[model samples]
Target: MHQAIPYRTWIHANTRDSRDLPLAVRGAGVDSASVAKLVSENAVIVIGRRGCCMCHVIKRLLQGLGVNPPVYEVDEHHEAAVAAHLGAATVQFPAVFVGGKLFGGLERVMATHISGELVPILKDAGALWL
Candidate 1:
């Protein structure tokens, strides 16, 4: 009665068009200043890819904790530049930033949450009232 789509096909279908992306945004060779500006402005930011399961997990985790972080897709923004700027080139994607600072990726975020440090950070950033 129902058909299941392949993972790759689903990803392709959901991917944003390159033309829709902003001209100022770039991937690997992007400027670090732009990334810094973005991080410094947002209370909570998550740079990730739409098709990444880990990214989804990280977002959901934040939401579960009553925090709504802005998610920027790598395909739509200069994620590499942000990663390099944050000195997290080795661990990008689902990269978290709180209180205008790098909070690390999935592992770090999970560790912080498990250690009960994430809530205070979110509160400090004004991302969570509760």
Candidate 2:
């Protein structure tokens, strides 16, 4: 049987981990304790609408990647300014704020994911790896 879902569905019903390949491999690299400490101390704020497809997708993506950043709803009482600035002007849903910087919307997130930059970026921004 065939199933249908929203365009931005971040479904993982039958998906498996693609982590078999080396994700953090390096020929000659040194781990920095300071960076690790800094990352652990930061927080990521994800602004999104409750029913938005892209929003759901982004949320699921982050969660599946083992990162559980705090999620805020634009329609909620708090985070009004953030929602206003993101939605009123740009009509963007799922506005991700990493380290207090606007990280754009779902398209940007997809781009980052496709480009294989999301992991490191999220790591640096302290948004993921929970």
User: Which candidate leads the pack in TM-score?
Assistant: 1
Instruction: Compute the lDDT of residue 122 as modeled in candidate 1.
Output: 90
- Supply candidate 2's per-residue lDDT for 110: 82
Worst ten in a row by lDDT for model 2: 21-30
**What are the per-residue Cα lDDT tens digits for candidate 2 across 1-130?**
8898755313221122312212111112112332222223335545565555676677788777777654444444333444443334563657766675677788887898889988888888665644
Model 1 alpha-carbon drift over 4 Å, by segment: 1-34, 76-79, 85-89
List, residue by residue over 1-130, the lDDT tens digit for candidate 1.
Answer: 8999753212121223522333122233344564566567668877776557887788789889987665655664555555667666475677788888778889999998999998998998998887
TM-score of each: 0.65, 0.54
Best by lDDT: 1
What's the count of clashing pairs in each model shown? 0, 0
Candidate 2 at residue 121, lDDT? 82
lDDT of the structure predicted as candidate 1: 0.66
